[model samples]
Target: MKASAFMYGLITGSVTAAVTILYSTPQSGSEIRSSIKNASTDMKHKLYDVKGKISDLKDSITHMTKEVKELVPEAVHDIKGSIEQWQLSTEKNKLRLEKEISAIQTSLAELEQTIAAQQK
Candidate 1:
């Protein structure tokens, strides 16, 4: 049972105890029956209230799930695009560095040839 139901039981029990003590006499059958009827009505109303709250909770969860499902594909697509762009940028940098190294090596070879001729 919910906290509210327990609270209701406590409240009803306290009230009944107080009333019976003050009266100091046994209740008639009709009085007992009426009190029971009222208690059942109260409990029934509380149960319905609890049910409504639970239904609202379920609806909230379903809505959140749908929103997440919709967002997942968009997030994946963005990540894939970012990865592809990163790979392309890395390839371009690599090619540029290779060309620069080849040019440097060629300049070094020409400098060495000139030095050898001078020595001879």
Candidate 2:
């Protein structure tokens, strides 16, 4: 049973015990019957209130679950797009660096050839 239901049961039991003890001391049959009936009505109302609260809580949970479900896929898609863009930019930078390195290598080889001719 739910915590709320268990707590309500305990409250109801205590109340019933108190009423029974009080009435048992010295009360007419008609008065006892009337008290019992009032207790019954009060119990019914308490039960109804608990049921309504439970229903509201269930609806709130369902709405929150749906919102989370809807947001998760969109969040994942955005992250994936960002990763792809970052990868593309990184590849472009790598290519540019390679070209710069190749140019430097060629210039070093030409300078070596010029030095050799000067030595001759």
Best by lDDT: 2
Quote the lDDT for 112 in model 1. Answer: 100
How much does candidate 1 score in TM-score? 0.49
Q: Which residue pairs collide in model 1, if any?
A: none
How well is each residue in 1-120 modelled by candidate 2, as lDDT tens digits?
A: 899999999999999998888767687778877988999999999999999999999999999999999999999999999999999989989999999999999999999999999999
- Give residue 54's lDDT in candidate 2 (0 to 100): 100
* Candidate 1 lDDT for residue 35: 86
Candidate 1: stretches off by over 4 Å: 1-26, 93-120
Give the alpha carbon lDDT tens digit for every residue of 65-99 in model 1.
99999999999999999999999989988899999
Model 2 stretches with alpha carbons more than 4 Å out: 1-23, 87-120
Q: Can you give the TM-score per candidate against the true fold?
A: 0.49, 0.50
